[model samples]
Target chain A: MKRIALLLWLSLVLPLAAASDAHREYDAMETYEPHVRGDQSLSGSYKHWAHPGKLDWRLAGNPEENWKLNWKFMDPPFNASVHGGHFALDRGEQLFRELNAKARFARCLGAGKAGLKGLRARYPQYRADLKRIAGLEEVIEYCAAREGRVLQNGSYDNSAVSLYVASQSNGMPMRVDVGKGVMRDAFERGRKLFHTRAGKLHLACSSCHTHKVGLQLRGSVITTPYGDAVHYPVYRTRYFLQSLHLRFAECNLDTRTQPLVPGSRAYTDLEVFMTALSNGYPVTVPSERD
Target chain B: MRSISILAGLAVALVLPVWAQGLPRDAAVNAAAPNKTLEPRVVTNSGRLEWLPHAHNLTPWPTLSHEDRRPAPKPRKARLAGPLDGDAGRGRDIAVRPDKGYCIVCHQIPGEEWPGTVGLDLRGFKQRQYADAAVYQQIFDARVNNAQTVMPPFGTNNILSEQEIRDLVVFLQSLE
Candidate 1:
């Protein structure tokens, strides 16, 4: 009789404790609103109709104030909340900042300068609407669904969202600057990761995309990394809207290396480096691939 | 006898749930959610492979090969250890398999085209600083010998089995 009573009590108490703990881990002040059309690539609206003004906005101009957004990864608060320790957090922070920085830059470009030429050249067609639509929420959905597709040709099978994003800069040329500054360290690190063999295959980003640009991988023709970032989002017929950092994370996984979070610093740094590498190429999004 | 049989049955039932609970779970990878459509096929230089597995969070790779099923003691240094058994043909297949060991991605091997420049060309590996054990160590997990190595830990991470590593060693050795 005592044993049965104990088991009942234990199961009930343990589940309650676990549930509360999960509740606390999530951002208390934040909640996401899913897509209305019921698209899996978009976050799903739970229960009934949408809640107004509930978008969990990322890159609120800067990251210092938004550390708890779940997307502002590796900050001291986030590390402490999760007890992520030092080495792991340190590496994660680098990647997070890099990705966040690029997202910030892309947003900046999209808001007003998307279609301009030279350094500030963003696709003129893109405006605040593009950034408004390209939410990290969708990225979370994409990651959850595991919808990445790499064509037999080395280029990614991106989505219309990305293609729409990239096309905004169609008339401009890529002019990403790796000017001498604190950011140079990030650029260098990104370059190092590009060449370094990683992941299960022990292959670097340069293996297929750089050194073997024209080489065939299965049925896919390897494309150059140059000017690839300009297409901020690509509409891969198979994969759908692929953000720049998402593409980088997908590549990291392919090389068999554990990918940092999508908006992590490592990917951001990689983007900065890659964008700079393709400095002179024309920007196009939703680039057609086989 | 009837009471004892009842007790035995109760014990077996109790143990089964515990065993079922202990089964491996993929909580680490939440990307395994049911998809609306089946994933598409992706053919890469590494033969027929899928990108969906890569997208999903880290999961232990499916173990292949029954050869050399033994594992060396963990964290042991084998930089100078020479391998005992290896198959050159198998090694070559692994090297070229885009989904498997892409050794050709970095080094230039004899008779193999499409070599990369990131690592030393293995075309003349026989005449250099590479000892047989050194080659084995490097292939297994070059990090053991060099902490900063960009090379993957093939053996340590179970990316390649013990037999597969030995086969790679032999193929690399015969490159000259």
Candidate 2:
């Protein structure tokens, strides 16, 4: 009888202890910086630029120097402009207002644009009514469905609107509530997904992002996962206007794992896990990557 | 009555595919079907294309998912007792190729450009004087020596064959 009681006590206490350890690791990753070759001044700036001809001239000089120059030029732009128009952000805002007009998101979410402000920072939270964790994309899709519209996850319209909504919370620190309820479960699942090795290569996300940060994989440098969640719905040179789930799918393909459906429970949980890691970092959306 | 209903369901299930085959091939196959397999379409320079069915039917490893807490494969003993007779040239090729050993991704091998600095530099690896079998075992599974190693179990996981690991061993031994 005593052993049974002791076993029950251990089961209840062990998970709580493990949760605290996970939180400690999360705190460490939030501030951890991996060393990489680049000018520190050009880290997060968008205004720093060189003329196209001069940039080309420098790129032609040395092959090794070009790799460094690429990183210097690849910093996320503050306002990503493509073909003389902020197409993604503009389209996103238009869709957000349109969806709002049809669904009256202002009624439930908040009134006016002020309600939209800092909204992105609190997402991937447990929605008690829905009885599950909901990311911004999932919430948007749910609202869209009520208006007799189908907004597929990772679709262009979905990404664009998500980008706009996320842009509203720009400069606000991300604070995903992983303290209680289903959110804690989701957070734990996300952490496991991030560290678990899968697919043909048997490489976990941490194998490159954490263990081999700043190291070269083929031609590209492996980057740290810190502050990465800030820039979602980002435009990349190879893939224009991509959502975070799309990026996850791309990573899954790279590791030869079958990609999960976007906005699925697992992916949303992963978003929550990753976004929580960037707790103090300001949200930066619609950024460009190379 | 239940048996009759079950027989009717089975008959319909068997006939459905046959009926669908009368339609266009593309229309017959539901794109959203979960188990639908796709063929690799290879387009030639002349714009000619062919669908090579099952050409890319590579199955993912039967490894544990993120939720599973199962430990990875244990280290195995070395297959051979002595130095393997492998082509050093082929071993070098395997080490440098991105799809194969990709040793250059972490190890800074001699005369390799843009080698990563994650692992120790292997310029004077030959001077270490380790036996060829030891090197072979290390490449097969580094977890034997270091339980917490980030290195993948190439042999155990079937990422590399015995011969490929042997080639890698020869390549590493030749590094100077």
Candidate 3:
């Protein structure tokens, strides 16, 4: 009888003890940890992401001076040699830049002067023609299509343009209109999606991103969605591609929940919520990812 | 008396066939009659069983020994790696092994909360091209073909040893 009791006690105590240890380790990592990038063990300054207040706003104007872009984002794959040979920025990236500049300068749309800078701070607003709250990308797409310029898909170049243009507005206060009618309805819809629980895990977008912002998950910190929306067409190192909407769509699918379609109403609402969260935050387009 | 005499005649007549039905050998013979040796059977590729002449030769039925001499075809080479033999449950756990290195850190996977949306989903990979060596190469060294990829060669990274890579290869290959 005594042996049986002891066995039960040991079983209960061991798992509880292990569970506490795991929890403690995770809890302790909430603060920033010094990370090693390449050869140097960057002090808390270089590797650590600065708070929104510390970011320099001047670099947005100079196209050449954007240091945040990484070599991994710029380089071609090794296997591409099977093509003609290993190509350089002189081949693809340069053309990309030329097209980008031409698109901006053409201003074929009456959406007003190249006013993309900081325009992300005021998106998912009520558009008179659509009679619905539309995301910044949607408006851009509409303008592109109506003005007779070839509109890139909402999930594609719009995302890229959003990032680049929003970067110019970094540090600006988010100013999405929350007035009555279409604007209010869209905002509410976005809020509902943000807060609604779904998926096998029964988690909401706010569960991890909102409640746990800056909380450590493994080695990385949880970035808040508030200021994150300001950077569109984020150029991540993993795919070495530029498409913020692609990243956004991937996140929803990864949530283990039923994935919302890329250009669907749910994503547009989610975008509204995200952009509104960072309403006051300045844009940082084409930001580098680790 | 007339009715009784008629009934007695009928009863005697019914007993013989009823008694024959109880015989085991007769029953077995009746069961086997449908598959009797004398009847020719045709086996179609569609598996439709048809009773037809079995002999293909006009001169005489070919000997059983002649039919058995044909050689079998060689099996095709596997394109994708079969599932890894290491712990599948452990493989699932090892797949999420942050200590080993999180695949989701670079790759965007559905159902993981707040994962880095950097690479393609690793799910449904087996369906793309079910080859073991291809999977091994993908997990081992993606840079062998594409250096521009942000995916760190997990095996080459020294984060996961060769054995762990095999285990992960098994886990990823098991995904739908």
- Identify the candidate with maximal TM-score: 2
The order by descending lDDT is 2, 1, 3
How well is each residue in B1-176 modelled by candidate 3, as lDDT tens digits?
A: 54554455445445533332222121111223433212112121111212322111111110011111111111112233444555545556666656554676645444566554345666676677656676666666665655333344555434466667777667777677
TM-score of chain B of each: 0.58, 0.62, 0.47
Candidate 1 docking band: incorrect
Q: Better model by lDDT, 2 or 3?
A: 2
- Share of native C-alpha contacts between chains A and B (below 8 angstroms) recovered by candidate 2: 0.15
DockQ of each: 0.09, 0.12, 0.01
Model 3, position B94: C-alpha lDDT score? 60
Better of 2 and 3 by DockQ: 2
Q: Candidate 3 local accuracy as lDDT?
A: 0.43
Cα lDDT computed for each candidate against the true fold: 0.44, 0.60, 0.43
> Model 2: per-residue lDDT, tens digit, A1-290?
45544554555455535533421111112222211111132232111222211234354355444443333333334233552114677877887787788547644443355678888888777666567777777777776676666666566666677778888787777777777777777777777667766655566777677666556665667654555676776776666666787688667656655455566666787787778766666676656777
Report the C-alpha lDDT of model 3 over A1-290, residue by residue, as the tens digit.
45544555555555445433421000111211111121112122222223333333343233332222211122122112222111211232332244446565324222356454545566656667776666665565666555444434333344444444454455566676555666556556666556544332233555565445444443454544444555454445453333444455445434432232234565666666566654544454344554
Best by lDDT: 2
Stretch of 10 with least lDDT, candidate 2 chain A: A23-32
